[model samples]
Target: MSTKTVAGNYFEDFTIGQEIVHATPRTVTEGDIALYTALYGSRFAATSAATFAESMGLERMPVDSLLAFHLVFGKTVPDISLNAVANLGYAGGVFGVPLYPGDTVTTTSTVIGLKENSNGRSGVVYVRSVGTNQKGEMVLDYIRWVMVNKGNLDAPAPEIVIPDLPGAVAAEDLKVPYDLAGRDYDTVLAGSPYLWDDYEVGERIDHVDGMTIEEAEHMLATRLYQNTAKVHFNQHAQAQAKIGRRLIYGGHIISLARALTFNGLANGQSIAAINAGAHANPTFAGDTVYAWSEVLERIELPGRTDIGALRLRTVATKDLPCADFPYRGEDGKYLPQVVLDLDYTVLIPRR
Candidate 1:
């Protein structure tokens, strides 16, 4: 089986109830760990330093959950969203077990439902995806929906049905890391004035800064996420393998997008629900990441009125902000340098 990529739109080409297995089985590495620490400044002991991890009773540092999620999601892009219109939403997500640096990740999705847009040019598809380690243990599972263009709207619909998904995971379903039961609170490393308190629903934040990635930077990230297909690392692989020249780490884009949300959505620092998210395009080194956000909906949790939920979008770019960064072009294609567009629910303190 050749590993050639899917082209044009994925919509008109898809069949309902079909199970699509995405290409790319990647193995994570230590280089990925170093890059994540330098970029995000996440000091969670389980992921940051080896000594800290063992002190907490773990054999070694584990990978970030965010990193694992993105790797699993990226593998599915070619087959699932090659012709997607826009992502609709997400739900039913659960992270089962922690992933180590050496674990290889591969993903598969089941098409759960389909809905046709009234205009006939586009329709919606829902897929349930699960990520598995090399040992074949399930690490994560989630459902996501995307708007995909129909190859032929005239093609008769197989079934006009949409699967039901929950808006948020029950508190009981959250899998807070066992080793992360306590925190030392290194304010210097965390880089923020806000904490569990001092946030308000509807408030927004802009994390005013940008960084340019290099070919080496993104490859390190992809490898850390254990997405080590030759295309991401070996420049020789690109010429010989025919993959793109530089593979940017998907997490770098995620960090930039999340950081950008700080300006308006900073108050929602404690993320309660992931809701759903996406990497709209492939990012390469030399891309300048920028970010901004809007508060979508607010919800108050029981006995936790001090914090509320805020849904937001974080986008990244290549050079500067694209006049239209995330939208499709007149040719109906994604603009270059717009690496990611993600929607998620975060926790903020009550004003």
Candidate 2:
């Protein structure tokens, strides 16, 4: 056996306040955009057509927000969640400068909290990760916590520290990086008549489409992100496990849900912030995924009249349609079929 091979980090190896600079800085390219579209079938005009993006006041066709997110999030897997049991949730995610083709992104993380599970075999580890472009400007900043396994079961558990995370990203702190001022947005080309002002709080839309995930496709998507999470790829190691199958990467579901939103959210082109998110259940190959969204708030940006923000909660389900909006039980627990609960904000042109 080669001792130089990476064994990955476990629960016992983490400590509060530890800083980790993840490896593999990836440069965004048109190929990545193409593959992302091929995978998720995203049809938003701003990212799909260069001329449309240019007319919208962007310097160039920008990378899809979630694609940029996965690329940066992938870099942290080797050091942060290789032995993860599950990715719990996300919060305070703000997209900064737009990610354009040819821009390179790197990531870094700091451990802020840790707790050993009562069973002593696993514990939750919380980290805040920041992704930056070649110009040293932030592309994305967010916090996420994962349940990780213990390599040394007998190792003494560290002092439990659960970091205080925000319930949501404040509207005022959101960065509106692109200038849509005075730009003529074509609702005809956008594919949706509804704009920011058209939506009222508490409105729910069921995205009436579903995509069945294939094993090979999920593997391809995982490889595209360069995500090296063991549970996603190690089939030989999973044969004896409880699920007995390769776990679908959670990010895959997020992208699928985002792509489905295009039917109703076509004019909601740009994702400005991810207020909060959670992978409620494990997703696997062969699960047919469905999605739906609710308008949580309609926020007006200070001094900006051309655009408005919509705080939305998008829910994803596996092998279950969202026409009835399958979400939680009266006891306040995520339904067994639900896979993702994502709270985010999108920037839409005002009519």
Candidate 3:
């Protein structure tokens, strides 16, 4: 069976500068859009309706940013993190062209950094992956580090290298895929009255809703993205681990939290970039998730008056509400209830 089956990569097998072209390009479909909306109940107009997208000067409505992100990220999992302990963090994520249905996305990645854990049982691998459409247009570009188990405990550790990542995606570097072009934007239909100019730096918003994860629902979400992460699927394997159940995919929490943002940030229509993110804690089935966001900075484009950007910090927690905005503790670690800490940028109309 040595050449008949694939067991996936382990920590010791990775090296810096290695380029990996991931398998399987996925075509986005209206069916994918429908299932995603049913799972998260996302209501962003520009992505929700083709008519609303035309009003925003786009030829066709785009899929949700997080959906595009998940599809791309899923493509990298088998080669990058199949025998993984956890996916640690993400940084410098930039979304380029709008991903409309029928666009096929393919992903390729490069090993940028590697560090063996002190225990010799695991190590961290940093990879930069780029997802491009069949037209060769970039869809999503980002960096992520994952902690992976070592299949051979006796294998020697390689030279430790950690890539220097950006603190945030600079405003000048943001990609504005489309302009409003003086078209009419209906606030009432969009579900929010607030615009770019109405929000202030450091303003916090509680999304004011909670959703409990179901065992079947999390599995469906994982499969919908075609994310073949064993930890998310194999309850038998996970039952032996400390968590003792099927682990919920981290992207599930990101999508759920992003969906909750609609209640307060409905007008923050398009995601431009993901500066950074961390899954502070693991989430399992039956845990109720809630979310909130803080405006970190406001960005004005150099020559555009139709729209602007907001650097946002959106936090998601399990079994805790964000009324007081739960986050880092006195020790600088995230609160136990916190599941996701995401720093991203979104575009909103300028009123």
TM-score on alpha carbons, each prediction: 0.61, 0.98, 0.98
Model 1 poorest ten-residue lDDT run? 179-188
What TM-score would you give candidate 1 relative to the actual structure? Answer: 0.61
Ranking by TM-score: 3, 2, 1
Per-residue lDDT tens digits for candidate 3, residues 5-68, read 8889999999999999999999999999999999999999999999998888888899999999
Q: Is candidate 2 or candidate 3 better by lDDT?
A: 3
Clash pairs, candidate 3, are: none
Q: Tens digit of lDDT per residue, candidate 1, span 205-308?
A: 45466666666656555544444434355577466635547555455676656645554443343344466566667766677777656455555555453344
Better of 1 and 3 by TM-score: 3
Candidate 2: tens digits of C-alpha lDDT, residues 223-251: 99999888998997777667578889888
Q: Is candidate 1 or candidate 3 better by lDDT?
A: 3
Query: Counting only residues 3 or more apart in sequence or on different chains, how many pairs clash (N, Cα, C under 3 Å) in candidate 1?
Result: 19
